[model samples]
Target: MSKNNTKSEGAEEEQPKGKTCFVIMPISDAEGYEPGHFKRVYEYIIKPACTKAGFTPVRADDIKKTNVIVIDILQRLLNSDMAICDLSSRNPNVLYELGVRQAFDMPVSFIKDEVTERIFDIQGFRDIPYNSSLRIDEVNKAVEDISENLKETFKSKGDDINSVIELLGITKAKLPDKVEISAETDLILKSINALSSRLSSLETKNVSFAAPKVVTNAANDISITFNAVDSVGQVVKVSDRVKHFKKGMGTVASIVSVGREIIVSIEFDSGDTGKYTNPVASVIKVINSDN
Candidate 1:
């Protein structure tokens, strides 16, 4: 190759590809708290610091549709650069989503409402505390600290992945040859990553996840969510099988989250009713809720 070609190849190799970041937060908690706390903190404290540090903040509240929100949010969690989870108020949904993120082994930072107990058995994950009475400078200082910590985490992870790949004597060029469908799917993921990077660059911040694309043919929407822990002692692919329902004529497909556990939603068209006879899929996955 020519010198320019070699330089181009090196530049491409140095570029981190196939990743995005999803911020998982609880808009509500077990205490019936709404989105006020997060809104105030994000708008007043966290967001400006994120912008200053060049990080994109993706929150679940920014999503319009519930179904799309779930898909996009989860996808970003699984595939993104890093995840920031606010554990304030001990929200079940936040905890559940955090579990999913942990299962996928993504880099996540937890924040809490200062008074919430760390009762959950999620060991190792620590929460950053913020007092409501703190001055703006104090809050900004905390955010900057957290941002630095996250950046360090990303650096460490990169080193770790490189070490693992080297130990296994694996190279990106040696990855399994993806089939046509898989290639298309990879393209879809790559597009998301590229767009994510572009948006981050344009915003001069870290890219946050947008809502996911929900595919449904129903006049009135019905959503069923399937979430499972990777408890089967074996790696499971959420997209391993297409879940089908009787009389619905549609299949539930898992869009595997790259770094997190897989979650797939199955939506039935209006007026479609039939017994779902699929053999409970598998024990590796759980239905967090089918509503």
Candidate 2:
């Protein structure tokens, strides 16, 4: 072929042309798994399977960064041509997204690590279980299994085999008609902005009130002590007592700093725990500080 024609053909080959498979799975490390474990699973196993099955795999994180991440996720869950849901860690987000896919009577392939127990609601559905050890030979076999499953699942899309709607004898959920940004949405945005402004003002006021004051000790030496809310307003240190708007009273069990944001993990009094990012300052009130 001529140079230009050959170049054109190569360019076309590089571009993916097939149905998109949305992979609903844990993007972060689970409590029991090593860090980046799931990442490796996706890279080594799921991605190859999707390609072999003539699909372009799209994960939640693969979507182009957008201001409205939840909206983008919901759109993909509702409208993707097919999906693969990993139930390994029983991650709430993963289950929720899978539920959305099932409710719409969409075609999906289910997979999980051998160690994880199947969810009660979905016990009847067939899921391809793979060894998490990721031995080379085992991984190769899993890739084949998943690729074959994807092809079979897509071919039988009209049967709705794993659909919860079909099992419940209820009408399948339909995607909502796309609508322009409405006045109600605009009002909600304005309200959020107002609340953010108020929080900023409160933080500033708190810093002023919590400013350190010099003191003379009994031995006549200078000393400095900090009051609560001095370092970061409404940001609790480890072991601090806090009350969440929904999760109730909790003790700050751990705090991790990621980039410029702080991730706070709280152990609730009700035996539940949660992790929140920096904006958690708005959702929680510090009842007591370690200081």
Per-candidate TM-score against the hidden true structure: 0.45, 0.60
Report the CA-based lDDT of candidate 1 relative to the real structure: 0.50
lDDT of each: 0.50, 0.77
Model 2 C-alpha lDDT per residue in residues 1-291, reported as the tens digit of each score: 001132333342322247899999999999989899999999999999999988999998997743356778988887778899999989999989988888888888999999898899888788998999999999999999999888877765655466767777789888768757789997886676677667767766644432334434466533223333434544356687988889899987876655545566889999998987653344677887644
Cα lDDT of model 1 by residue, 63-162, tens digit = 5542334666776666567777777676778877776766545566666666667754653345567665446777877777766655555544534322
Please give the clash total of every predicted structure, in order. 10, 0
lDDT of 1 at 160: 35
lDDT of 2 at 286: 81
Off by over 4 Å in 2: 1-17, 187-291
In angstroms, the error of model 2 at 227 is 22
Which 10-residue window of candidate 1 scores lowest in summed lDDT? 227-236
